[model samples]
Target: MTAMASVISKITAKNQVTVPKQVRQALGLKEHDQLRWIAKDDGSIEVKKANNNDFWGVVMEQQRRYGSINTPEPAWGPDVGGEVID
Candidate 1:
């Protein structure tokens, strides 16, 4: 079996961490891509790319289930006018 190289990253004050370039390249990750973190029973965390279609499917299903409830109308009416400032 081939051995894998290890990379390290530090988390910022805002609790944001950057993925190492090697790991990103290995995973074929790109900008604006989503990741899911899984916490294992052994207290280890695993990260994987999130499936966009599954995410959107859940969103659409929730919308279909509760789309109309407690929705607010637009605050401004068509007759309301405002001057544009340069």
Candidate 2:
């Protein structure tokens, strides 16, 4: 196994930091790619590539912490709606 080199990046005044070239290549990150910052119980932070299908992870976490979200039924019915004509 090849040893990974440590790289450091400085956070700018706007709170943005550029991912190092080596790190970006290793993670297969491209322009406009999304990353998720996860805070661990050990006071450490982890950065991982964000997947579009991971939205359920957020919903499940919210449900576990604060119970499922309650959404109210629509106030208006189809009969009272301004139906669009095709």
Candidate 3:
């Protein structure tokens, strides 16, 4: 019989997330299965399926945003609040 299922995972108070049982079985994933998170152009996070040994196997490209940010930049230069040492 074929095995496959769809489910949603929730993050815990400790910033930990658990994969549903059905999904784990379908993806052949067990505890400690390595996964990677990516930020899209809209700043939305996407979770992609990956192999444990392939954590750094794939290189992610930079996303470009179409609009300008309305936030102001911090004025923390090289001399913020520390002493200067030449």
Candidate 4:
């Protein structure tokens, strides 16, 4: 279920606007927070709270730069060894 919050704000000249209180609280946003936006083919817009410090985007970039780490399992050291035969 989704909780509906009512917020009212106006768009500035450069399409910049402040997020209202109820909306911000609902989204758990704070000052100097970051938001990710994607414009869909349709006029309708879908928005969701982005991960902390843009982790998703950074992970993708890291993968592209430093390939994937899918190496085979490494051998364990002296498994099933008898109690130190000192």
Candidate 5:
């Protein structure tokens, strides 16, 4: 993980790609671990380990900074129509 590494994994007919063992070890990933895929403008993909606590922390930070409205649960409100395109 310290040094740069590259790995390849084939997409199955079901569109599922098995995480390469080396990459899994580098990411400290285990079975059932959630992953987040980010598509960059440069046509490359970034994979990250998804942690619920990290996600909630981000929402809490956003609420703290932007000030949440009075509701049973904090809501960010209406979507402004930003959409992702391939």
Candidate 6:
């Protein structure tokens, strides 16, 4: 695997870390974006950008899984707030 450049960040007293500018730029991060943290068996950790109910992302995933062209209904369940499209 190719080596990626690393940046250092200090954890705040409240256990928060400011994602460095370079990392944020490379990851295309934005304010209010969520991150998913993964822990590997080798005792190392990884951070990945988490999707925030991205519409196109859900569409593509459904197409790949169901092989259907139709937009998949959101599984927001029976009592959710979104309106019915039809």
The most accurate candidate by TM-score is 2
TM for candidate 6 is 0.56
Error of 2 at 63 (Å): 9.9
Q: Number of backbone collisions per candidate, in order?
A: 0, 0, 0, 0, 0, 0
lDDT of each: 0.80, 0.83, 0.63, 0.75, 0.83, 0.83
Model 3, 1-86: lDDT tens digits are 26445467889999998877675666677666666688899989866566545433432211133343457989876765877799
Clashing pairs in 6: none
Give candidate 5 regions above 4 Å deviation: 55-86
Clashing pairs in 1: none
| C-alpha lDDT (0 to 100) for residue 77 of candidate 1 | 52
TM-score of each: 0.61, 0.64, 0.41, 0.51, 0.58, 0.56
Cα lDDT tens digits for candidate 5, 9-58: 89999999999888788888998997879899999998888775787867
Where is model 2 more than 4 Å wrong at Cα?
A: 1-3, 58-69, 77-86
What RMSD value applies to candidate 4? Answer: 7.9
Q: What order do candidates take by TM-score, descending?
A: 2, 1, 5, 6, 4, 3
lDDT of 6: 0.83
**Best of the two (4, 6) by TM-score:** 6
Q: After aligning candidate 1 to the native by TM-score, how far in Å is the CA of 38 from where it should be?
A: 0.2
- In model 6, which regions exceed 4 Å deviation? 1-4, 54-86
The superposed Cα distance between candidate 2 and the true structure at residue 30, in angstroms, equals: 0.2
Please tell me which model should have the higher lDDT, number 4 or number 5. 5
* lDDT, residue 24, candidate 2: 82
Which of candidates 3 and 5 is the stronger one according to TM-score?
5
